[model samples]
Target chain A: MTYINELDTPCVIIDLNKLNNNIKDMQRFASKNKVTLRPMIKTHKMPQIANMQIKNGAKGITCAKISEAEVMAKAGIKDIFIAYEIVTEDKIKRLLNLSKKVKLSVAVDSKYGVDMLNKYFKKANNNIDVLIEINTGLNRCGLNNLDEIYSLAEHIMNSSNVYIKGIFTHAGNVYGAKDKNEVNDIGKYEGNFIVKIKEYLETKGIKVDTVSTGSTPTAKISGKIKGVNEIRPGNYVFYDAIQHSLGVIDIGSCSLSVLSTVISKPTEKRAVIDAGSKSLGLDKGAHGISKVKGYGIIKKFSDITIERLSEEHGILSLKNSKIKIGDKVEIVPNHACTVVNLFDYAYLTDGEKILDIFRIEARGMVK
Target chain B: MTYINELDTPCVIIDLNKLNNNIKDMQRFASKNKVTLRPMIKTHKMPQIANMQIKNGAKGITCAKISEAEVMAKAGIKDIFIAYEIVTEDKIKRLLNLSKKVKLSVAVDSKYGVDMLNKYFKKANNNIDVLIEINTGLNRCGLNNLDEIYSLAEHIMNSSNVYIKGIFTHAGNVYGAKDKNEVNDIGKYEGNFIVKIKEYLETKGIKVDTVSTGSTPTAKISGKIKGVNEIRPGNYVFYDAIQHSLGVIDIGSCSLSVLSTVISKPTEKRAVIDAGSKSLGLDKGAHGISKVKGYGIIKKFSDITIERLSEEHGILSLKNSKIKIGDKVEIVPNHACTVVNLFDYAYLTDGEKILDIFRIEARGMVK
Candidate 1:
């Protein structure tokens, strides 16, 4: 059997035991809360992991792009959700094609998006389900005002080829939570707010089937809320330094890391690893919400901060650590999703023994 | 003819005319300064572009990793300089195999790297050329002390299979320059510093054949310095917002742009594009040296700031702009190299007409 330590430097290694445990824990948590888990595949982008999640009890998978959803659908996933707004004709066409392969639903926050979806699906002589995105917070997308939500729901229901299946909100703002208390507060609001919108839509004779809310940091709390039927937490499968910093999980729970070799020890207190932005990624957090202080946390040598990164070099600030050239180190990146996107494949390891290699099949599916 | 405007959203587009002009201009500048151009292929990672550079008078190509060099070599590239230290046994074996295919040179900053190289090449009964990396100011890698440099040079000279060929420095510190004057200062120092190191080695009875220094912002000034015989500038082929912010090149000189679509207008003052960190990259600059204000520059609407990104969505802060859903917009990313690494292929466009598509053949070659 191959060992993870024997793998080439600057490669991604996923702890298979930790990965399965994470999947089981999240699935169990969702089941206990009576909320269907529709884990976002964008975190790993590996069909194998998605299939594993499915086998562990995920009802459906969520994707950030139609291209990603297409990968999942091709890999035998029966239910998929594109959790981002679909606009351009090329994407809408792809979305319709993907819809034919699986039970597909898309997110829509704009009247423009609803119109485009309606136009494309009507021309294709097909119908598509859509989740009206609500802006409980995060302010990135979705409608915040009750009037806008009502009007968008009406617009989607009025469309001949479009059906309003649910309402969802990503409380990504919890990533910026000042403390665990703030995370809990945001989680409660995220669930209550989306369910409130679903109730509001029902009051107007509009049927809202799903009340979905999610974010790795707030998923458990939000999923446990009354009336929230679905949770979509992507990063929980591979808790990163950002999640760890936010009190979401501990270092041992991190399933993924970049296996890098110490390539240089330029000074007594400084060393450099082969993994950089090209391998580990440059995600402090979305909009600088994370409290992560450096590029990553050097596994086992947690005191050694990854001070900076170039394209292919990570500069580490060390204490009295004896890191030297040729020494291998594993780095738990600040953000796992972005880090996973930078690799073509990752080795699955049970502790030190590498079991298999899985392709990040949906990587670079930005279109 | 296919038009760039008609292509899929969140796709990379290279202006063929601008790309050609950039290649020619940089080649002319290097030739005029009497320095051999060894453009780093890490920026484009396309064999076609590397071949074009060679055809336009580049002496060789530079790669950050052996895998990238392997890709270039497989595409019939004859000479490659891997400007990073290679450690592990796996990488060294790959390096030796690559040496058989091309005239390969690697960088060495420590005795550890030199000793590893010597051990591998000796075992394989082969010799490899190495350039001593000098830390001019970036402090990321390379030797800054003269005594250490002397010892490393001596160690390599003592090895049976290792030979010292040159000394090089990447004046990446210029990325943090406050203005053009500072960039010029760093450039002059970068060239002179490596030349001084080469002279020092020579005075100690060591023969150094080449003296190299480069950084897109500092290349022009540094290349002009006497005794600096080689320069390697990667991003000069497709200058980005970081280069523009550093006054290295104008926006028109930037050949690469992400063709994205406005997917959402969540508020009157906010619009979201399909391109996000996945397409544009999150490189503000290495070590936070870049003065770039945002993730990228939205062409035609300079006033619009890409405030933030969420894997598949770019949130734009708009002020009275008429951008709407389904409208196509091109964005010039903050860093071209990282941005190019995000795509599988990029469309070559001669203004509006699409000429060809080039695969990013060496993408995700972090290993």
Candidate 2:
């Protein structure tokens, strides 16, 4: 068997045991809370891991784009939820084609999105189930006003082939939480607000089947809420520094890391690794969430800070450290989802032996 | 012919005429200065573009990794220089194997890297050319001391199958310059410093064939310096916002842009696009150079600031702009190199008509 240390530098490695544990833990949490787990495949972007999540009791998988959903569907994932608005004609056409292969549900927030979907679906004589997105603090692509939500839902219902499947919201604003208490408060509001939106839609003669809301930081708290039935947490499969900083997971629970080699010792206190922004990715929590201080966490050298990154080099600020050139170090990235998207393939290991190599099949599906 | 407006959103579009002009202008500048133009291919990572550079009079191509060199080599480029240190045995072996296919030379700064190359080359009964990397200004991975550089060159010369072909430096610090004057000063210093190192090495009985130093912002100034014979500029082929901010090029000269659609109009002052950090990479100069004000520059709406991004959503802070839902906007990314690595393919356009499509062949070659 091959070992991880024998592999090349600047490559991604997933601790298989930790990955299985993370998958099982999240699945168990959703099962115990009576919530349908639709883990977002955008985190791993690997069809094998998504199949494993399905084998461990995930009711469906959620994606950020239709291209990603198409990748999962081609890999035999039967149920897929595209948790984003489809407004453009090319994407709407691709979405209709994708709906023929799997049980697909897309997210919609505006009348423009609904009309685009209706125009295409009506021409093709096909129907698509869509989740009405509610704005619960993450004011990205969701309807916040009750009247707008009502009118959008009415417009979708009046369309020839569009139907309402559920109501969902991503409480991505919890990423800006200062502490665990704030995260808990945001999680409670996220769950209650989406459920309240579902109730209001029901009162308006629109039957919302699924009340979905989640992010990794708020998944457990939100899933446990009374009326929430679906939890779509993406980052829990390989919890990153952002999740750890927000008190969501421990550092040891992080399964994904970029195995890098120290290629240079420029000074007594500065070391350079072979991995940089191209491999590790430059994501420290987008949307001004600056809780993550550095680019990544060096596994055994917590005192060593990854100060900066070039295209192919990561500079480390060492503190009286004996890290020399040729020393191999594994880096836990600040954000796992973006890091995974940078590599073409990742190795599955069990801390000692390389178990298998899985292609990040859905990576760069940004069309 | 298909038109660019009919293409999908959140996709990369390259203006063919501007791209050709950029390539031709850089080549003309290098030729006029009597410097060998060896353009770095990490910016576009497309073999078609690299061939275009070759046709425009670039003597050779430069890459950050051996895998990228292999990609270019497979496309029948004769000469390549991997301007990064290769430390591990596996990579050294790959480097040696790649040398048989083309003229290959790599960079070395530390004795450890030279020793690693020496040990493998001796066993394989083969030799390879290497360039001594000097720390002109960017303290990422190069020797800064004169004594150490002499000792490392001595070590390489004394080895069984390692040869010194040149000395090089990348003045990447020009990205942090406050104004055009500072950039010019840094550029002049960058070219003079490497040429001085080459002269010093020659005085010590070591013959240096190539004195190479460059970055996009410094290439023109450095190439014009008296003794610098080679310049390697990667981003001038696309001339991103970082180059524009450094006053190296005008915004109209930028050839690369992400065609994104306004997916959501959250409020009158806030607009959301289909692109984000995934499409436009979060590289506002990696070493805390924050001269870039936003993620990218919108083509027509200069007042719209891309304030933040999620994985797939770019939130724009608009100023009473009429950007509505389903409106398409072209965004010039802050850094073209990292942004190009985010996609699998890019479309080539001539103003309004689609010319062709090229695969980003060497995109994720971080290893």
Candidate 3:
């Protein structure tokens, strides 16, 4: 009922048309590849958006934390996969409760994590499915090679309360790829690695059902590769300036932007917007996608650079500056995931009109 | 009360003892210098802490947004200053409504912002106080020269609905100082700038009342400078790793830290903590205070480097390699303000025991 112009500045605006196009594009890609799409909810963190993805033929939803899974489950999501390791008695207890409510699965890497899961699962007299998180050149988490993964898989299979579902890898390194070809190469390698691991596990009498792998950068290429049965790309739901820089998505495909108002014209060449690091987020062209050279890319003003960000002030440097005081502008942030997490509610829009406001239901679910 | 040992991982923990000491130290410094202390509430974002500052002789509270001022006003705070340019009609109306409830003042760097303010104040049939934001050296937002500031002041004085309160400057560049002496120099320059501006305005028949300037890095030196009548330092309440890096406060004086659990030990050199950019924030040693290198400084693990951050995974490069799975660790983030804004609630602690949970009441108040 409200108009976009009437909304406040420094608020998140999600373009509904682009959003649906992104969702349907990924869903169609998954369908054509014969892989189940289970979009990661960490990017959007909205249950309604997750429901949209599910309604668009997504098999389930992917979450990064137990609390995120709990939020989705509470919103009537039946199948949820917590793509994170849950350790400690407190979290395990919460995970057990969450699992009882929905068909929940978690990702694990170490014997320590598996043992803790087994302990809590045994106490509750319930069995839970788990995926081994394997790092495909991300060097962030997961087993380095098949040997280490096999050991963890054997340990999980030995446990009475834990079931080994499959292996999943986040090819986050593709965010650092040199070009589109490199991104596809990394995706191909990730899919091949998962197929190799699944074949090895089968030979060892450990049947692996799923080989879920892909990041937003590798989503298209990974689903096309054989043996990668599932794709869980989070940021593809709302492509960012970084993804656009990486040539993974078009600039027009970017669905999320911070609607900011020029609060100050400090100089002829410098203007200040209401959106700062707190709204647009402080991700400076992360993961080597450096085409867009600034804090964010200002729409329709290619010459304007969001040069810097304070806690609450965004400084824009301009060459042919037309920005004036009180002018409303939309900025495509470098990273959409962090920007989505920064706001309490995101205004859904259809470019010219406001649709609805979706509360970031799973925000601040770090624990 | 619960013991600190029972608290969850990836949670913000504030040392109450250290916090009290920080508040008292800043208060004593302000008193010794005969300058009014108006602690910026953007650092803590909690009304309880703002009240603590008030009880310790703080003249008022400074906020980065009108919504933050509104949050404090709802919690019964009387005197508040929003230190940012707000231009929209909706915000001006809210600001006018807020001024009615409290002694509210706002910073304006543009005539457009002031015109909007004048329009709203005229509609309400009320006069609102305003501070002219001037840039000493930060190069962010504010008037570039004394002439611009004087023109803005004269225009404001001509306006029937607004009153010129004073001038304010933020020495944010003090964070980028090469050494402590450089920081002092920046602080001194800030004080001198204020003195010159106040004197110039008075000679022009514009009476200047408050000369407020200070950032946490320059708080100790700026308040000691002559002619600086008021100091508004935010991060002094929760001294961060960057402040410690700048030698503004000792590492032990850092009151805010994110408590995290080691979730994965992938290699001898690599360990992953549950706290990542979502918990610790993605500041990356802002303002060029890079002495405490990495994403953050891990307490009691001097040899370990918080190498990088993913969304929910902090990759640690361990030299000594003592951290194990499920072991708890505390991290002092690079920027306390952003870290405080990340979580919904922060655990108040006495180092070893949990005292209370302070809800970040003004969190996500960017609008």
Candidate 4:
């Protein structure tokens, strides 16, 4: 019963059918675009899911931290791209060690990033690929400046241990898109920028192997770029309410959901569910209303904004809704990626039948 | 080094001095007001911390979920209050059978919520106490009307094996307070509502053994109520940056801090930390300047706002200062309560010395 019935509530339930379709769709897109699809494992955090993606023809997996990359390597995922800037004494040692097990490629955006990385790994390591993360639009965590790309790539190639492999950028700006047209525009803009930089780096005689760009919205509507060699999209694996709102994917395409029981019906409009800030995070109102509703749109309920959520309770008050007490509702979170980080394991189902229970192996390793 | 590092940037470290001081303060407040102190176990979720509160004169432990209560029960906590409405067949079994280990009390709001709880426990071998949760102002999950509570309580009291154990309400309203004056105003309003309800219930010949009202900010200023018999405040144990911003306590008095490494300095203005929503949750904009900054404010790196975070990266951008690589920064998270839920284990520290390591046993149990 624990496997089927005895497992806790508010745990993730992954629809295997939707998940499989998602993997194949991404593969199809990569094949159509003639780009190596390196699906980031940071989205699902399950090694088995990584295997599923690889089995469906992903070139490699992209990880955010060394711990995640180590897990992928242990699970026999040799071709790995750590899509993050790695620094610090202990982390670099771990990264260098990971390179021994797997084909590791790390991202760098500054000269200081390369200096610390080179100092740690150059002694034992012969060649490891490094990608310069360019800030196409998201000012959060990438290098901005067309002038800096050639020098940045040169610095990495000049390092005795590291090879200047490519350039990557997350079109996080795509999430800010008003519609699908804007998303496509962002994709085109990003694609052109990466190609422009790739050509610029090649003219400067730096080996820019992988020109990549992805964010859920950009990844979904992305057509093709001549020079871009790879794509590193993460969230398309299990599109959430946020994705659907942005017209990236449909609600039926969302694989992950929270199974919550209705706790209280205080009023006609306002019902309460067991899920709260703990299960469904405070990442609401990020994109839009239809895409990411209050708390979560009750899958059993209709168009209901889970208007308020405290630590332990979620208050649901809405128009155009028919829901009842004791009814177990599936909630597609505003942001599926952040919610997945809250649990150690999740139940994967093919909707009709439960597939298997998998532990989120590298869910929280912040060292 | 992760276990016993001088740097505090990887995990939540509770200050013993502030914890002990806060405990005495809560106990003294409860004692002077002639109210029972059942410090909510949900905040710390550590048996040792709960035991310390009990040793310093708390009546019992208050937990949000039954699973959390079970963990505390194993640590020898006797009287337990689960301050959440329980539903579903699986949860009903938990409520009916939990008395095998310790005394269990539950808070309920709706007629359906009480009926289901009573149906499972009314004929049970062990007696269970039910507390009617009133909607003072939080409007999340509580009985809205006073009259409905009497109906719900009478039905429970008249049931075969269940007992009515008075009432409870979270002055969660205080979270909206603009200042200490507003907090005090809300506290008095909370006291007035609970006192009136207590008197009304007593006049109706109901056994109101426990009349509880709480929340850190409200409880800090709430002196005495005529009929309220107990106070249950969970977040006070590890007062967070939100509490500090509310003027209830100082930042120095905050008992919890996340020890993290500055893993990536990809750009000049922005650096990234290993800890993100997985360790320090993206529970940003909870209170004030402390609230709206980001998920956490760097205790050491004040000029940096952990502005945006992905699943595994906390984007620390220098607002007006510089953050170099390999720097270990301590962050005061927006809310300490949810951060406690993020880790599998936590290290209890007395400044530079590690006292004990605790497993957050009921972590990830959404049921």
Candidate 5:
């Protein structure tokens, strides 16, 4: 390992002790609520971190793409759920091959996705679990009608290689909530909506075993709704400015930060840092949460505001001018997942000492 | 070589013919005005592309960081100018080593930067070219006062191992121009402003040889303002939605696009594609150009608006979308530079034939 000062500028640093605490705290919450925790690996994308979560009690892992699942499977992760549609023939063939090596389940929202999966699984002479994704309120993707859910379940049951595992929904709209009460309302609606769809399928003689729904904003409150058997929250692993503004986590709980050095003090009002959009990922805080203001929150100098960014330069507007050239500072970005994907490796630290390095092995696996 | 149909989804495709035409056009413009062209490699970050630029009659190449200069130097490029400040001892050592291999010049706007470089070069028994960066109007990293410029130049001249090369400025504020006339005005100001600085330095018997200034929007008009010897214009190589909105390049000249597949049509108005913020980046378009509206402009479907993006999903709000599941489409991101840094490799193609694949070699070298 190396000291933090010796590391390169514009690098990602993860607090290891805070990381373990976040993982254990989430696992404890899931266990107390009698619900399974399937953390999404899209946040960290490190195999070591995923195994740490599993060792502490995550039931499985949630991935957004087949390529990410392949990375996890190659790292010996046996249980994986791809919470996205797989419609292409090449992606289906790859998924079928991955199913032979792991307990694979996929979320399907359309007939075309299921038809392709069923076609490939039949040729492989194997069966895979399918979860019907329903739209709770986020109009992005998912089946919005109960009749369509029932029809898709029946189609899955009729197929020789596909079986109904359960129903899942992502309460992504909670990210736009104005306060905690609105988040609670969205959580209740998300949990009840999934249960309603699952109960409707059960009335049609289909046994639905799981009802999974959650986002970081609704994870804690949605578990009390009595139907969400599994909660998949990704951002809680390393909370950020958006989570801080949403009141999902305190600012002190944020474990990921970008370490940057003030390279130029151009004027009394401006200081230029080495970290820019390439390191911080041009996210402008949360949508409907309390306005946190600025691209990120500077850890040391609270009066400094990150006014703007070019490709490799972050312009900070100084108030009272407490910063100087060559001074190092840490910035908590608005989103941790995107920032994690920007770096090739992150320094694992324990507040004072460096523990090890975490390689972002699954980065750029967007396909 | 591979066919476009044989490539992976959510991949970048560069039109080879369009790329060469863009390179030649910029070269021809610079040659006609008798200004040296130093295209910034931050747009593509590929050694192959830099070599191509140099081979097409570019005088040198420009980089945004010392690590980028190191990359180009290792690729055998002889003339390189890092258009940003280098402050830390570690970075200065790297810069000095790079100077040993190539004719390297760096921009400095602070005493701390020049002091560190001077100290390092003194110990190494070598001298390096130093350019004082002046703020034309970007309000970013640059000295605003002529007195500070004179003092910094005096300080560099007094140093035992540092030599003053010239003065430079980036007309980054031109991106916010509302019309071509404003762009032309910014170009003229950027050129004349540096010439004035050079003239003042000459009065002090400094004999500044170079006065470099240009941006993609101002490059076409800046050279005619007299006394601006070199123009460093990036982003014109692969124009994006922002450039198209600024009237810098036509939409037909944009060479880079993300090839994506419509995976799900959840509703009549909404379609989901595989490319998202992770592939196309989260840029909202240019600074103050005309609002081209949307995250990106789809090549074939002009009526479709890319409403939003998640980590791995692009949500399209369609107006009578003829798009179905599994249909391939190309998207030109709002900003091309960030999108280029997102992918590890990009497909090179002519209109109907696959030409080659170029890797983004210097990506993530933010240090």
Candidate 6:
């Protein structure tokens, strides 16, 4: 409470109450679906926060990179799923080292990527549970066809240090959907695809256990598919405006915000704030009043569209309110995942008072 | 060069020849104008690169924040300018520390910010030079009128730690101008504006020594400005696609690029690359090429658009290019300033081989 306004502007603040509620929502939804929730810890890399998800009934934690998983493992998270491909020799070495330290599983979508993974495990004298990443609908990083998936899975099964444990797909394509029904329909299609793939692998005498499919927008609506045992959704931890826009979670459940001060009144229509791309981020822009905005929403000022942003300055324009220079504003950012990467630590608040501080320990761990 | 491809996909590559040439070109321009070229070191925070700038005829260096100045000072670059408003208490303390170590000058726009400088100098037992930042038209930050500027200058002259150095302005608004004529006109206006302010301060018995203004777009035709004694342009050190769009520099002068590999070849129309906002930033979209669709330019392949990006994946779609999964591609980002901040270091290359490894020492100095 003492350092509430004393701390510098353009600082990250997380409402612990809202954070707790968002956690419960995910846990309850996972329980209702009768699926184990391995909450993606990449959203809030802080140990204590990651532990909170476990306390709320998550089976384990999921991470995107080896460095992030290493941080979580060191912080005492034993079960971790690195839901990304460990492509290079150096990265595979990091993965092999991590597998020795914790219960680790990695996602692989390419034969070339899997070959490196198998070589690493053979070199390390160890093994990692491998998941076949499926394209399904998200045409980013995944297998294009059933033959490609089966061949990669078969190669992994034959490897001296690789285990084919599951198949996973991220319904990231749902982010650009039209409405809730569209997202739900897309989520069901992804679920059906994963279930069908599991059955196809089973018919081929390949025992498939984990069939995972999720994205923040789709995860909320994706109920129990016939074969999905584990759900790995990370952005659900701190759903932003983009999530709220897709009817994933309400703005009320949004936990994080950027506390900024009005620095300039460029004109009657435009007011520049201290936070810009450095704080708000140049991610996807939002409509209005999102759990977060591309940059951030000017708390109560929905008419203020963050049209453009430079690195150190956030340009804001208000349609109704007259916010003068020196006035402090709290903004919920668009994608909370990207926004949190900018800061070293976040001020944990409960709407009215500052309670604690969470170090963004996993910040700048790009490699 | 041993770890060249050992590095991950879609990372920053600084062409050393282009970098040196760009620096040389600016140096020659400054020399011809008979002005001090204190190049903005914040663009590429490599001490080695800063030294190169000096070796090529830079008078000193300019920093956007105190942390940048600190890094440059640690690297033994003595004379520096913190060209941003040092607002917070923590930063002012840093200013005092930096002042003791190096010859430091900061920018001040308002009477309040000036008072803070004055108070800090008096209390911290340190003296620092300050440039009165005038609003020539980049209304982002600076004093708007002469009376406001004069009052702040007077305050600085009398304050214990404050020393009035001169007047400076950024013709940032010139970047928004449509053509070279507007660029030249803005440069002339800024030059005259600074001269008038300098003369006014002289009449008030306050010495105005440093009269500087330079933004890359304006710097192109800024040779016409007679009263200006210095020009501090940052982006010219590494001309980007945006600068090329602005006609400030040729496309060949752009030094940095994202070295990426095609990760997914799902369909002929779409081939996803292992790079996204986490790699090539979602800053300004494309330039130079006819298509201005989104994100960055796909180097030799002008038709490909990196349309949508997630944290680690760039979804690119082109009807013409037959990009295989392992095929390598380079992307020239929309804006170099924001893209450079994402990495810890950049490999300096000569298009064919690695020249030097440069560390972005001042990556995140938000405080």
Candidate No. with top DockQ: 1
| Candidate 3 backbone collisions, by pair | none
> How good is the docking of model 3, by CAPRI class?
medium
| Residue-level error in angstroms, candidate 2, position B341 | 0.7
Docking level for model 2: medium
Q: Which ten residues in a row have the lowest lDDT in candidate 6 chain B?
A: B284-293
User: If scored against the real structure, what TM-score would every candidate get?
Assistant: 0.99, 0.98, 0.98, 0.94, 0.98, 0.89
A365: Cα error in model 2, Å: 0.4
Tens-digit lDDT track for model 1 on B184-244?
Answer: 8999999888888888888999999989889888888889988899999999999999999
DockQ of all candidate complexes = 0.81, 0.76, 0.73, 0.56, 0.69, 0.32
- In every candidate, what fraction of the native interface contacts is reproduced? 0.88, 0.79, 0.75, 0.63, 0.74, 0.19
Worst-scoring 10-residue span by lDDT in model 3 chain B: B283-292
Total clashing residue pairs per candidate? 0, 0, 0, 6, 0, 6
Worst 10 residues of 6 chain A by lDDT: A285-294
lDDT per residue as tens, model 6, A79-138 = 988887766676688888888788889888777777777887887677889888888677
Clashing pairs in 4: A1-A6, B8-B259, B9-B259, B9-B260, B10-B259, B10-B260
The CAPRI class of candidate 6 is acceptable
Off by over 4 Å in 5: A286-290, B286-290
In candidate 2, stretches whose alpha carbon ends up further than 4 angstroms from where it belongs are: none
Residue pair clashes in candidate 2:
none
Against the unseen true structure, what C-alpha lDDT does each candidate score?
0.90, 0.91, 0.88, 0.77, 0.87, 0.76
Candidate 4 wrongly placed segments (more than 4 Å): A1-8, A125-127, A220-223, A285-291, A320-322, B2-9, B264-268, B285-291, B317-320, B353-355
Scored by lDDT, the top model is 2
Badly placed stretches (over 4 Å) of model 3 are A285-291, B287-291
Among residues 3 or more apart in sequence or in different chains, the pairs in candidate 5 whose N, CA or C atoms overlap within 3 Å are none
Please estimate how well model 4 matches the true structure, expressed as its whole-model Cα lDDT. Answer: 0.77
Instruction: Please provide, for model 5 over A278-340, each residue's C-alpha lDDT reduced to its tens digit, 9 standing for 90 to 100.
Output: 988777643222356777889968888888878888889998967998888889998898888
> What is candidate 3's lDDT per residue for A10-105, written digit by digit as tens?
888999999999999999999988999999999999999999999999999999988888889999999999999998999999989988889889
